[model samples]
Target chain A: MTIPVIAQLDELRSTVAAWRADGQRIALVPTMGALHQGHLDLVRRAGELAERVVVSVFVNPTQFAPTEDFGRYPRDLERDYAALSGTAVSALYAPTAQDMYGPNFSTKISLEGPALGLESITRPHFFAGVALVVTKLFNRCAPDVALFGEKDYQQLKVISRMTKDLDLPVEIIGVPTTREADGLALSSRNVYLSEEERAVAPRLHMALQDLAQVVSRGDPIAAAVAQAREALAAAGFDVDYVEVRDAETLEAVEAHDRPLRVLAAAKLGTTRLIDNIAVPRA
Target chain B: MTIPVIAQLDELRSTVAAWRADGQRIALVPTMGALHQGHLDLVRRAGELAERVVVSVFVNPTQFAPTEDFGRYPRDLERDYAALSGTAVSALYAPTAQDMYGPNFSTKISLEGPALGLESITRPHFFAGVALVVTKLFNRCAPDVALFGEKDYQQLKVISRMTKDLDLPVEIIGVPTTREADGLALSSRNVYLSEEERAVAPRLHMALQDLAQVVSRGDPIAAAVAQAREALAAAGFDVDYVEVRDAETLEAVEAHDRPLRVLAAAKLGTTRLIDNIAVPRA
Candidate 1:
């Protein structure tokens, strides 16, 4: 069955309220509208958790810096709707920029912990934008559960921390990253890559996995990360960051007595790619 | 009837959910638990708006700086409970600091617009702290409406802006400021004033009133505000600030073509007093 599309806030609220009155549990999957297999998987996982599912597709301009890809970011609403036609999504909430952020809008959610380091250094305002959008989504949907892909590992942890700290009633669930056969994590920005850049993108993930293996072998974290950075640079990538940090807190780790994650962000030409792998303690 | 006091989050949720099942709309009145007539007025107004009312008495520590009075803030839950006995309050949610903010708390709500000038200049982190606690309260209570006293005029505007910006489902209502016959705004901190300080506290309100009258007589806003500061200082008050601003946006106002508010903050002995009055357009 085709999913009903809701653009207005009042319409979305009425539909969700009716579903709620019928005693159906609701789940939310927030996206940026250029749906890939990764977002589809999140929708399917949301369906498994709740009787009703909502997929919100807003590009969220606040999350993008002026130098970032806010203007060039992919947007295909018709294509996204077609992709979700066969899915269990009950409604698609695709609010306009004006709808999401009104003229007088002026609130931001600042976060620490998982939001520190890595992406924040280059994109200082990124997580604050993400936090604010996710908060609006939660308040609008009032869902029982929300699903996020672990492809953006830091984002998953940041949202989890926000939901807990704010005592939001919804439960946050992170699904494993969906990857291509070549092992590249699926992202909407993948469309920004040229053919040659796309070929080098998979190496971003490959380098993180190599770093995780090195950490698992009890190599010193700083030395291992430097090695991985050199490897990526040699492979024609402008490495942004490659570090090993605590999996939960995202703080830099000295020794792997606790759970650790090897995360990396690199640019192949103009398109940036990020990926992470879990490093089991030795 | 005596109000049932609930401190645990789980108990409060279950009670509110039961009320929801019975089709009762809920209202929340958040306070610091000193239980003055001002807070009681909010509870009474909440009772008029919804079928059930909850007063959350948490002295949010984040709102206070190290130099401020978080440690010496009054704490008399027993007295607070006694005060609400005959009111329309259905439940008192008096959670401890640990209950309201866990160890992993890392989220903060930063606002612009209404949170820009006035109180923010002196108390830089004040509105962020207020936004965070109010967000937690809204999530925890899930009320249909929330009431706030307008004695903290900037706070009322900030909360209203946050609710609209974040799309929080709760309707934020501003209760009129409850004042003493001598015109001192009722506040939990009012008890900290010495008898001598209390006697001089009424001058803050009187000065703002004088400023408003001058503005009404077509006097330039800057000169009127300057005159009010001199008057407050001459009355033996350590003037912190006396300014005229746009009532809604809290931005500095040069003309009274729009609604203007004359707000003043001054120190009398060891206590600080704040007051404001509307400036009638000439």
Candidate 2:
């Protein structure tokens, strides 16, 4: 069945309102266009949770730094629609930049706890932008449940915290990270990688997996993380950060008694790749 | 009729949901619990606009600076309830601080534009706190319209902008400031005034009125504002800021052709007072 596409806010609301009037539960999956199997997986999960599903494809400008890939971030709406066809997604909310952020728009949502370190150090404005856009999406769709890929683990945690803090009525659900057969976490940015960089991209996940095993074996966290960074750098990746921290709080873990996660971000050529894995306790 | 005071979020939501289910529109008037005539005026206006009215009285801690009046801020729930007894308010949402802000709360809503100057210079965290609490109130109540007093003109603008920017599905209505017989804007903080300070408090509003008249007569804005500040200082008050700005944007008005607002904040002995009046443009 051909899925309906909603580009304007009024139309989106009317459609969602009709569904709501019929007592149909609505779920939303927000993404930046270049859709892949991972995004489709999120849509499928949203379908399981709600009777109606909406997917928002917006490459939010605020999340991208001036030097980062705002202009080059992959955008293919026609391909995205084609990819989403026959999926559980009933409508696509593809707002223009102006539609999302009109002139004189100047509000920002900032979060601390889980949004403190990791990606924020390099991209300080990233989560604020994500928070702002996600907030708009939630308000626009008024969804019963919102789905996010756990691939952006920190983002999932940040959105969960934001929803709870703001007392938003929507339930936030995190879907497990979908990965390539080669163990590379699927991301829209993965398309930016050259053939050689693509071959090397899976190493980030592999290094995180190795670090998780070492932490599970009761190795000193600092030493294990440092070793993982060195290995990634040796594999031609410009390592950004490699650390083991509390899975929920994202705070540095001093003891291995609590649930810990091994997280890493590295630049394989021009594309920055991030991945995380849970550490099994001894 | 006596307003039912709801202390729990679940109860508040159930009540609001029941109203919504009956096809009745809801209006919310968010306040801090030292209810004055101005707050009741907001409730009255809220009643005029919707079938049901909810007034949330939460003394949000995040909006207050450590050096500011959080500790000494007045809290008299019984007096507040007594004051609202005969008003049009249907329910009073009085959530405990812990209920509004849980242990892991780490989200903040910030705004630029209208939130840039005036009050923000002294109370930096003020608008963020207001935005956060108001967002929660809107979500919790699911109101069709939310009323705010124009006594805090900048705040009204900030919230209006935030509602637009965040795409919140609620109308923000700014009610005109309710004033004392002597023209002092009614505020909960007025209880902090001593007899001598109370006598001097009306001068803040008087000076703003004078400045508005001066600006209307085609007087240079900077000169008119400077003279108002001098008058406030000579009136035995510690002046914080007295300036003329664009009524909507809160930006300094370069020309008298646009809608102008004369805003002033001054400290009368230990009590802080703020007031604003619309300038008649030439």
Model 1 residue B41 lDDT score: 94
Q: Taking the tens digit of each residue's C-alpha lDDT, what string does model 2 give over B1-282?
A: 667989998999999988888999999999988888889889989889999988888899989999889998889988888988878889989999999999978998989999998999899999998998899999888999999999999999999999999999999999999999999999888988999889888888889888889899997888888999999899999999998889988988778778988888889877888999999757
How many clashes does the backbone of model 2 have? 0
Question: What are the per-model DockQ values?
Answer: 0.91, 0.91
What would the per-residue lDDT of candidate 1 be over residues B1-282, giving only the tens digit for each residue? 667889899999999999999999999999988889999999999999999999999999999988998999998999999989888899999888998888878888989999987788889989999999999999999999999988888999999999999999999998888899999999888988888888888888888888899998878878888899898899899988888888888888787788888888888887888877788767
Per-prediction backbone clash count? 0, 0
Give candidate 1's error at residue A254 in angstroms.
Answer: 1.6
Q: Encode model 2's per-residue lDDT on A175-282: one tens digit a residue.
A: 989999999999988878999999988888888889889899998888998899999999999988988889998988878889998888899877889988889767
lDDT by residue (tens digit), candidate 1, A1-282: 767899898999999999999999999999988999999999999999999999999999988999998887888899999999989899999999998898878899999989998999999999999999999999998999999999999999999999999988999999999999999999988988899888888888888888888899998888888989999999999988998988998988898799998899998888899998899667
CAPRI-style grade of the A/B interface in model 1: high
